[model samples]
Target: MHAIPVSQSLPETLDPNIFSSPSSPKVGSEPQGHITEQVQTIWNPYKNRYRVLASCILSFANGMNDSAPGALIASLERDYNIAYGTVSIIFVCNALGFIAAAFFISTLSTRIGRAKSLMISEALLMIGYTAIVTTPPFGVVAASFFVTGVGMAMNLAICQVFCANLANNTALVGAYQGAYGIGGIFGPLIATALVSRGSKWSRFYIIELCLAALNFGIAPRTFWKYEQESKSLLPQPASEQQDRERGTVKRNDRTKRQWQSFKTLMSNKPTVLGALFIFAYQGSEVAISGWIISFLVQFRHGDPSKVGFVTSGFWAGITLGRFTLSFLAHRIGERTFVFFVTVGALILELLIWFVPSIPGDSVAVAFSGLLLGPVYPCAVHVFQRLIPRKMQISSLSLIGSVGSSGGAVAPFMTGMLAQHVGTFVLHPICIGLFVCMGISWFLLPKAERRDE
Candidate 1:
């Protein structure tokens, strides 16, 4: 099979310096002087596998950070002597971090290269973890989450871009995200167990601190060579094309070129649709996960201890769908499969909304998670296929970070609305979001290329 050309989808007027560092490298930049000049040699099997493993770790860390926030709320409020309303600021701060990262990470990735960007992110994460473990003032702890949020956004975007650019099969993407699902399953269990069993709640971050340290070690080794492997960085493989791009844009004007590309991508049909699609999808997913327990207890009069275990079932279903269905969707058709999955999830959500049976609602909740799980990775697969390689890192990051804010925003919105009405509204809100998801999917332009 022939490799898909990275520059094929890139605009002809694209700047050569978009992914290239200046000739005068910064003091800490990875040495790129020995980059090879062979076109075919860019594909290194061993290095490809190494990058995939690094992406898996990145995803796991994403899950580790995201899954614990809900579990920590009571602990954070009680231990820190903060009000419940004040503790909610943690989510607000984290969401702000994601939105802020979207605007800057593109420039950061372009200026330093993806490898160095991730290293900085890891360092930031370590700092955030260390601060959080101290159980400092509530405000300080909330601020620490914003620091961690920036780190996760950078890593998440960079890794998604790196893996997507590798142009490997969608199954690899499935497995990468599937690792996050596994981590999500484990994170809540461990966090809740330790807190409930007399362990200090803040101690959970010590485990994450250790994980961040491990990521710090793994990231540089796997990604430092990205400048050498990623095709768009230099024109060495196509010396003639290099000469042409050089003639069109000057070195000092590269930032202008980057912004131009960003504007074009922002206006593109697929990119816009992709963002809204993920916004609704993430909202649907997080709302259910965050509110299921309250919905079960408040509306259906279920036992808190008994119904809490149902969240495990929900997460388990998600993990299974991500690992299994994401791969299966690739074989069938990502777009078609996703449309049907949303429909199935819609059906289950209605069951939870209308039926008063706790056991029935519990089963519906798990099935809803099962169906919702594959949507994220599958949408990613679609985004990589539709968005040009040149814009994907920025666009995917925009989608990832902006879309992730939905996880926080949607649940928070549900909680506020539920206060006036009731927990029963969770299912209806999710259903409305899923319907928006369907519309977004319908509006998305068909992929010019689909992985077969």
Candidate 2:
């Protein structure tokens, strides 16, 4: 694709520098009088394939990290002699970790470059995994997840920014997310296999440790020169002296301007609505992935070994749906497609709740994942269309951070509620989240048709 000229129509009140570094502007940043060059796509420069490969590996690790909980929760409860509410503390801590990382990830990436930021993220994952694999006290185990949450949040934010800036961004983002689903598929499969075969629950994280170590070794090498590439790719309008002065100004007032931009984003209807949509979307998605195995075991009276694989089925559906259905989202219209799928997922959720049979619930759960898989990418596509290009990075960063918290908050709530009422509460909570998604989708501003 030909590089498009940067639009000069950005509002004076917004700060383009807030969403990017002093030297490297984000994909749509408009520096005065200069055109923004597009980032290299996988095909345009074959070297980017290495970067994409690394990102997929990172995402796959994340998928395994997130999905393994459902399969292992039973083992954790059994081994630790903890109740559902007590065991759910890990989810709460993990959420806090993600929230903590979200606030710093942008600034961290800016100050240290993407390469170092990703390395630190991997390091954090290694720390978390190391702590977990030792089968320390339950409190220690929970705290370790917080570290992993921080790591995963940083990795996700940076990789997403990279993919979103690529040519054929939608396709790249889909593949990136699909890798997560593939990891999701394997995570439960591996965890379930290990636990069911008389291994301790904590032993499962050894595999995660190895995965994190692999990424840690690869990340710096693959992304070490990323910022230099970005600087070269983005056209510089100002001379060296002017650029130095601009950089100084960015350093002096970066935090203040970023705060102001964040305030502006909060008040924007489309951004708020978009965040809410994704929040509900991920809440429903994670709630299912994290709790469905427990639900099957408790409600269906299915064996833990057998029911554990149901989570894998759900993630497998997500993987397949992301790969297959995401292609159709544009043709069907994202807004309309999301509405249909939300309704479809809600119906399947109802079937899962009402139909007590394990076989029937398992099928419903997988199909629900299939319908839900494409919503995230499609929502992002609509956001790209609706939000101003200059503010897309910050807007999306905020949206993703908030949405990830939903993943934590909803499951935490489910775990707590399940302690008193039973695991059946998962269905109602997910159903309600779907309703929230539909409402948020309804409230979002219409996406105007525009050329990329």
Candidate 3:
């Protein structure tokens, strides 16, 4: 086994070989020669910048694919003359698809390279979007969404792992996720504008399909260059040094370590509390976005076109909030920042519920978006800090999958509630979830302060 240097901190330029090669040296207990080779592979400024940019673009694609479907639902329902309850089945299908993919596709990504997995996912998205645009039957539409959900599941699960590998500092994970917020903001806004101008809703899918294609097409060339540059830094492995050069740890040890880390994560009080916080945060976000159009049109008596724009405004606020807070949270503190934002979100939700005019309600909803934006990503950032790096993908996937159940359940409940009571009731429920998030935020264990 060839010994290789492994840092306490993750290297900026991660070689696919480090993760893939069975013969690679164990970290922390490698031989002197292996240590020298690994040290040489440390990320430089330019390489780090490239990885950051690549990860951000991947995140942007994730946001664009995710937000587009929800935003287009209003127009789809109108054109199809479907009941709101029936329209909501799309979300359920999407969520179920996500959950299924979380269990199945993410494991596939680990076996096939992350890059190939991502590329396949984007291609699936293109196919799904094409199906939605070309096919007419409601069942087909739902099936299309399910297919997209698989892609979304793969994208969300893998993108962060990719980013986490790229980032030298664990602290920047939230900021990296913030780029997704930017994509979320623009995607819906652009889709809304297109729909408002009387473009067919199917056009949105076509545009997204093309974008996914473009992203997939460019990935191989760029990522290959990155991989090569990263690999060159490591020392050539000795031909006969199989056992010694492979270092102290075995594959079974790595697997055991990952499982132990996950067990540690599940048992940790702070991690559970943080996951709960994410659950509430995601539930509230989905409730608002999923029900906003119905609320505006059915209860508040706003125009469909105008409501679409209002919904986009809400996403815009979320995007802006994430970008602003990504930098600010590192400066202040995650706990303190979460406290302030949760309070603001609660207040904004109340204002959104009570406000009379569409314009006033729209403005309030936008502000609520801003306040709600930072909570989830920051919670994720905190979780990453608490857990071991090797286990981050599996642990995060497990937690995120659980929290995303809220994304599924909330919309379903909203549909049921609207059927029984009225669409306007979603506001009160959202406000209540925000309150729960705020309380949960306080319950999370505070990270020890480190001089930044």
Candidate ranking (TM-score, best to worst):
2, 1, 3
Decide which is better by TM-score, 1 or 2. 2
Clashing pairs in 3: 1-241, 1-242, 1-243, 1-244, 1-245, 1-246, 2-245, 2-246, 3-34
Off by over 4 Å in 3: 1-51, 168-175, 225-262, 388-390, 449-452
- Give the clash count for model 1: 0
What are the per-residue Cα lDDT tens digits for candidate 2 across 1-452?
A: 00011111212222242222221335554566655555467764555788888988989988988888999999899899998988888877887787787556765676688789889999999999999989999999999989988888888877766777777778888899999999999999999999989999899899999999999999767888776765666544566337667666564465576566667777888889988888888888888988998998888899998989999999999888889998898898999999999999999999999998999999999999899888888888888877876677777776777787788789989999999999999999999999999999999888765543
lDDT of 3: 0.65
In angstroms, the error of model 1 at 84 is: 6.0
Ranking by lDDT: 2, 1, 3
Best by lDDT: 2
Q: Can you tell me which runs of candidate 2 are displaced by over 4 Å?
A: 1-32, 44-46, 239-243, 246-256
Global Cα RMSD, each model: 7.3, 5.1, 6.6
For each candidate, what TM-score against the reference? 0.82, 0.92, 0.81
State how far residue 337 of model 3 sits from its true place (Å). Answer: 1.6
